[model samples]
Target: MAGRTLIFTGPPGSGKGTQAAHMRDRLGFVPLSSGDTLRAEIKAGSDIGKQAAQYVQAGTLVPDDIITGVMLAAVSRQPTSAGVILDGFPRTVGQAEALDDGLAAAGRKVDAVIDFRIDDGLIVERIVNRRICKNCGATYNIRFCPPKVANVCDRCGGELMQRVDDREDVIRTRLATYREQTTPLIEFYDRRGLLRSVDASREAPAVESDVVALIEALG
Candidate 1:
């Protein structure tokens, strides 16, 4: 079967990535998380990854050309695979248009666009207090899911550290950039009647319920 293509979009720290992860598991969707992809690229020291790292560290959007090329290549490879979920890709109208063109060429289209909505204030608090396990990539929040030991991962005894972008100042910058660059996507997809909103300020399970409801309705 030709799996579905889903675009998950929201401001930084709105738990959109988390929700995408949930849906990927529940629906057997292949997740193409752009942030994770780019981070891996950076780790490998690819040419484009080098370019992206500079912008990412500055809390700025990587230029549209670089981001679009990377995502398009990723999507092209998955045309015949399990359902693919786009997490944190196509943050601007230009990118969306490019995605549309690409999919049209492949006889595929976005099954739905999931828009996670939350206030900027909550986003700051959520991201700033978040920590990740350096070894296993397990995530936790100081306020919500504090670990058994501070600065330690409960699962693997890995050290927990704040992501550079997860710092307070960088989080605020990401939010501002998200509002400026990605917010219009809400209207962009809404005009096409493919946009669905999930209130992401709540806990992950509650948000996942609404998100699942939306995706299931697509059938």
Candidate 2:
């Protein structure tokens, strides 16, 4: 079965990435994470990645054009017949419009947009307790999915560390930034009647179930 091109948008700690992985495993949607993709490009020292690296090194946001360029290129490389799980990108209305144009040119369009909804307070709590495996990039929430050995990764023997952005203050600021930038993007898809919301405050499996049901309903 051909999968659907899906966009998963939500607050930083809202489990969109986690749920996207579930979709990829069960539904065959190729997971294209914007952060990971950009990092790869930067590591490769590609021209576009070089520009993105400057912004990162300067502690500033990468230009929308560069971001859109990376996204379009990534999308173009994917199989025309397969579905994609977009973890990040189209973070604003401008990118969303650009994505629409890009997909249209490829004769494919986003089949569904899933918004994982959670309150700011809960998000802060979740992020603060979250830890990552430095070696494998696997995430764990101390309150929900803690590792058997404290401060150690279950998957890879790597030491678990809290991300700087997951600190309480940073999370609050990021939340503010997200609300400023992404609210309109949410409205954009909602108006198109392609947006569905799944409560992300629940457990991972429960949220995954809801996300899958919503996508299946899209058919």
Candidate 3:
């Protein structure tokens, strides 16, 4: 049987990555994140990796064609039964259309697009104090959900550091960019009848439970 596919879109600090990871485990879907793919490719030092490195280092988006190509490649490698949960791609209407076309060519279509809705002010507050473990990528919000120990990762005992992009000014710019670009993509999926908006301001488990309910409802 053809497996299910889901897309996740939201503001930078809305916990899309965390939610996607949780859903991957709970739903048995392969989590494919564009940022992770690009980072892996760049680390591999291939031709495309070299090309993506420059943009990533400069804190700019890689070109759409490159990102789309990478996404298609990632999806092509998955087992038909495994399925996929897409994260951090198709940030615009054009990209969404292209994604649909690409999936159609592969005899697949998006089953749902979960949009993590959170207030801009809350997003700013969450990101400003966010700490990430460099070793395991565990994220903690200093203000709300700090690690068990100060400046340390509970999972790996690694040092925790705030991401440069999570600074107040940078986060504000990222949020502004999301409003201008990613917001339209939400409408695109909604119009296609594949969008599900979930409140992300709650605890992580609560958010995950709501997403699980949405998936079950889709069945």
Best by lDDT: 2
RMSD of each: 4.1, 3.3, 3.5
User: 95-154 in candidate 1: lDDT tens per residue?
Assistant: 899889888776678889988888989888878889999999999998989998999999
What is the C-alpha lDDT profile of model 2 across 125-188, one tens digit per residue? 8779999999999989899889999999998889999988789999899899999999999999
RMSD of 1: 4.1
- How does residue 162 of candidate 1 score in lDDT? 93
TM-score of each: 0.78, 0.84, 0.83
- For model 2, the run of ten residues with the poorest summed lDDT: 1-10
Give me the runs in candidate 1 sitting further than 4 Å from their true place.
39-62, 79-81, 131-140, 147-164
List pairs with backbone clashes in candidate 2.
Answer: none
Clashing pairs in 3: none
Error of 1 at 116 (Å): 0.7
